[model samples]
Target: MRHVDELADRARALLTPGSRRVLGIAGPPGAGKSTLAAAVVDALGGQAALVLMDGFHLADAELRRLGRADRKGAPDTFDAYGYGALLARLRAPRHGETVYAPSFERELEQPLAGALPVPPDVPLVVTEGNYLLLDEEPWSSAVRPLLDEVWWVAVDDTVRVERLVARHVRFGRTEAEARAWVLRSDEANARRAAPGRDRADVVVDLDSGRVTPSAAPA
Candidate 1:
């Protein structure tokens, strides 16, 4: 709770009164980015809103079309251009208008359109997902620039792996299948996204219960 309180204050400071400030949280699967994002948004109450990057995940049908079903959480399996466009709108929303952002339905394993309403005066918008800081193609060129600050979230490998396995099991996979996917798909994606932390404005390491500044990229 103290950590969330401190994080909320850090996020609140990004507000400039009249414009929306975008704060992004990125991490490997099961690192608790969503949980942290929700806590920060709750701590800020009406001053902020949440827009998950997972909302831009390519639908399962689309993933199948692209032959990327096995790599569902990878960077290429998202609508990066659409996410960038959404951020652009959120950053400079029309006066007196509310912009609707999509939200992911984990239970349904799909995205819900126009699921979150971001009022023009919300001031702070917190978005969390896996590749917000990835240094790759559309993600690097389109999404990163739109974020005012990107926070990298992480926990120990063992904990993350266990959590992910449980999450997958809860979401319908068998225990053995869950472990396999986490090791094969999730860990690989995490390794690729890991280096992006060097460019982060802040890093939240949950296992250590610490939120610290990222070591600047060389």
Candidate 2:
């Protein structure tokens, strides 16, 4: 595994004085974006906080009501405009301002509001999710402008599948169910995630744990 400490160190270095330097960690499902985001905040102590894009996911009931529950994690299932506005707020942070953000609960399959809070003093805000680099309407133009740097976590497809299976199992799926879900749903998201890698400011080989400068899409 690539040493996570190096990534955290580099992310810390990218922070500018005053307000948060939104560092986005984008990748497909099971690529370790959430785990890596937690690690970054853990490594940085008080200097960082986490804002997950998963928090923007529409609730399962809402999805079901819309007849899109089976298509969860698809781009249309989120509040893209709301997320964009939140990023804009983070960019021009005020003293004593504390912004509350939502977090996803796998068991509940919904977003829990106020789960993550960003205080005025935190210099770095690490926001991780699958679609941060997505180049589609609203979402594509939403986040990139507010970010100081963007890093995409890349891993081998095999390792990613394994991680996804383990994650599903950990979150309460049976072994067979986990594998099926990974193949059926997660892979679709992964394929959609591929193009975003090219748009990343830094491409991180999470499997090997190496970071390389990458060109943005023309």
Candidate 3:
């Protein structure tokens, strides 16, 4: 819930006079990372673009083949290396060419190829996902170095979980199934991602609508 103007100002700072900058929004499920990222992009107007790590979700067939469909939102369920590679490419985009990125379709529950376009002239690319600040190999090595800055979104656990359950239900899960998924899958991912808050340049308190520089882990 941080003020949109403050977020826009931070994003604008990432813009160099003539070069591109990448600002990453990292947080666990239900933390409103996408909402915050979209707001910053909208505030920045045409100068910014968005690329979602969820876009790198492995196709359902691949997930089912790997026996990971049940835990579909887990870090391992995504094409982490591929996402990293795309970040690398976006970091050094070619002149005058649009860089296409995949997008996740909620209704279809699948990744759609080349669903988002990052035009060359865009000065800021805002990417959001749960794992951007993860220290794990390939991810830390491939992703962290490319980001100009990363902000961590934080919300109260009860509120986050409630929001997550409602999201799942809205997307076609039974209420019971939604609650089960949040407890079994999303909560586990949240725990795994908690450590990343300490690594962020800024920690956004969504419930309070405040943004502050990160300090020692709480």
* Candidate 3, poorest ten consecutive residues by summed lDDT: 209-218
| Model 2: colliding residue pairs | 2-209
Model 3 has an lDDT value of 0.91
Residue-level lDDT for 60 in candidate 1: 96
Task: List all candidate RMSDs to the true structure.
Answer: 1.4, 1.7, 1.8
* TM-score (C-alpha) between model 1 and the true structure: 0.96
Candidate 3 local lDDT, 79-120, one digit each (tens): 888998998898887898999999889888899999999999
In candidate 2, stretches whose alpha carbon ends up further than 4 angstroms from where it belongs are none
What is each predicted model's overall lDDT from 0 to 1?
A: 0.91, 0.85, 0.91
Q: Which residue window of length 10 is worst by lDDT in model 2? A: 209-218
How should the candidates be ordered by lDDT, best one leading?
A: 3, 1, 2
Q: Per-residue lDDT for 1-218 in model 2, tens only?
A: 35678887898797777646889999998888888889888999999989989999988888999998876888888888889889888877898889998999987778999999999898888998888888888787887677778888888899999988998898898999999988988899888878999888888887566788886653
Q: Write the per-residue lDDT of candidate 1 for residues 10-77, one digit (tens) a residue.
A: 99999996677899999888889999999999999999999999899899999999999998888888
